[model samples]
Target: MHNESIRYLIVPGWQGSADDHWQTHWQKSLPNSVRVEQADWLKPRREDWVGELQRVIAADSSPVILIAHSLGCVTVAHWAQLAPLDTLRQVRGALLVAPADVERANCPPALRNFAPVPEHLLPFPSQVVSSDNDSAVSALRAMEMARNWGAEIGILSGAGHINVKSGHQRWEQGFAYLYRLQGRIEQSARRRA
Candidate 1:
């Protein structure tokens, strides 16, 4: 990112993103990015995960842009609802990718706690990126969530889950979206000032 002062918060979902995952790659490459470590990745508790994210953010003073995938996406939404106004303001924007529809009927048992995903619009700008055939969520469902959250949506064709298993490593396309989101966030901040 061009903004040297901005921090990148990497939040992974479920068992955590694999070494080959794009989130991991980005964290490794970005000097200012750090993972919001969770206590239990195999069996995530919403309270615990959200608390960890909050702790990490509160410990930092710089503005942050969230990079989240799968369950991590839902976690960010939940935190947005729970974070204090001051802490929330520090978040510049978010890149929510392949967000799992935890509210869906087939919601996995481990992920049930995250069900009823926060419905309120995030105070900061954000974008939702989804694949046409992601098992966690369908294109239509993802688009709906994006609209509901007041975020820009991007739909990619035939990109299953947009994960390593789906062959997404060092996803350059995703980086393009990240850059655009950063620009929008920076522009909005300038206008607000």
Candidate 2:
């Protein structure tokens, strides 16, 4: 199937992306991109997040690419561990950005339950982008998680939190990376053929 036919699901972290967030903009720009709406954003129940993702994936027969930020990245990782291998095979790729340490997010006690999510490599190709000055996870720790997940690392220079507060309005570089990932996905499909 054509890449355009694939479903691009955007998973926002705690508090969910704002109206002007980059993810929201991406969803508007990309034809197939849609947000993975969770039942509760503040309380952040891991099982609920995973269940919603599974439901979304089940609803769409097209390939899926997950774009996750903050705690959402952790949700993706946690889901990967439980999702059937067959369901996982349909995932084309993932873009993990500013993943929360959970162990160090100074998160509320409710969210604290999900800590130090398993550091296992994902079966599908993925990219982990981190900021040099993220308050949530140190650059070193983010790199460590990237290595653990076997994902390519993209370091943002002097960026903090990589959020709206970091002055990241028009993230051209991120779009460039996504374009490159599209090439990688096409190459993988060719290999399968």
Candidate 3:
């Protein structure tokens, strides 16, 4: 199956990805891709974020694939934990990158509501990409989160946060990961058929 057959949702983290961020780049570069717009990016509320994500997913009829970064990954997890079976069935897969450890001591106060990250395994296929030296999240914790979410982990050596500031502008490798996710979605569809 081609990427055009899938609906890609771009979920940005924290203050949201800047114009040069990879998430934004992919949103622009890919067809049938839309960003899950949050009302407030600076002061994130877990419920609000998850609501918006669910709203977007509910509005789209096509098979959904999420490309989430940092806190956005947490939003996906929270939604997956609470979403209805129909909503869960619509989600084909997710590419979770640089999930912020919101439980960390130094985590910003605004993000504390997202703490106690949902431990339930995602109902759909997913892959997690983490950096070895992410300032917001430790590598060990990233791996642990991947295990908890039942997602395959991809460790990038010394890549800080895997954001634009980390020198990952137009990250081709990340695109490759999304492509792999599409393949997994296709395989799953084939099995179901």
Candidate 4:
């Protein structure tokens, strides 16, 4: 499938991605892509974040591929668990990167509400990308989460959170994963047809 044929929904983590962040860069570079903007980035409320994501997915008629980082990944899990069947069907797949371990000891106070991360398997195809050196989430924990979510896991050696600070701006590898997911989705659609 052509990259332009699929719609991409960029979901940024807590405090949101900086201007130079890869998510931001992808939104700028990719056509038919939009960020699921939260009302409050600094102090995010789980329900509010999930609600906004639901709204965005509901508003769009095209199939969506979610690109979520950190807390946004958690939001996707919660949204998947709570969304209506029709809303969930709109999502083709998800690329979950650096999912913050909200249950960890030093988790931020603002993110505590998202603790005990949703354990149910996601309804659609998904991939989890984790960095071996990510401070927000340990690689082992990320692997565990991937297993629980029924997602394919990709571990990046020494990449810290895979963010702009870690020099991942315009990350081609991540885009490759997105393309692979698009291929899988298209293949599945063909099978169903």
The digit string of per-residue lDDT tens for model 1 on 61-177 reads 898999999999999999999999888989999999999999887878999999887778988899999999999998999998898788999999999998998999888789988
Locate the minimum summed-lDDT window of 10 residues in model 3: 1-10
lDDT of 4: 0.91
Clashes of each: 0, 0, 0, 0
lDDT of 2 by residue, 120-178 (tens): 89888888899888887888888998899888888888887777788775566788767
Question: In model 2, where do residues sit more than 4 Å from their true spots?
Answer: none
Which lDDT tens digits does candidate 4 get at residues 17-124? 888899999999888998998889999999999999999999978888999999999999999999999989989999999999999888889999988899899999
Q: Give candidate 1's error at residue 153 in angstroms.
A: 0.1
- Give per-residue lDDT, candidate 4, residue 119: 88
User: What ranges in model 4 sit over 4 Å off?
Assistant: 3-5
lDDT for each candidate structure = 0.91, 0.84, 0.91, 0.91
Task: Name the candidate, 2 or 4, with the larger lDDT value.
Answer: 4
RMSD of each: 1.0, 1.6, 1.1, 1.1
Error of 4 at 110 (Å): 1.2
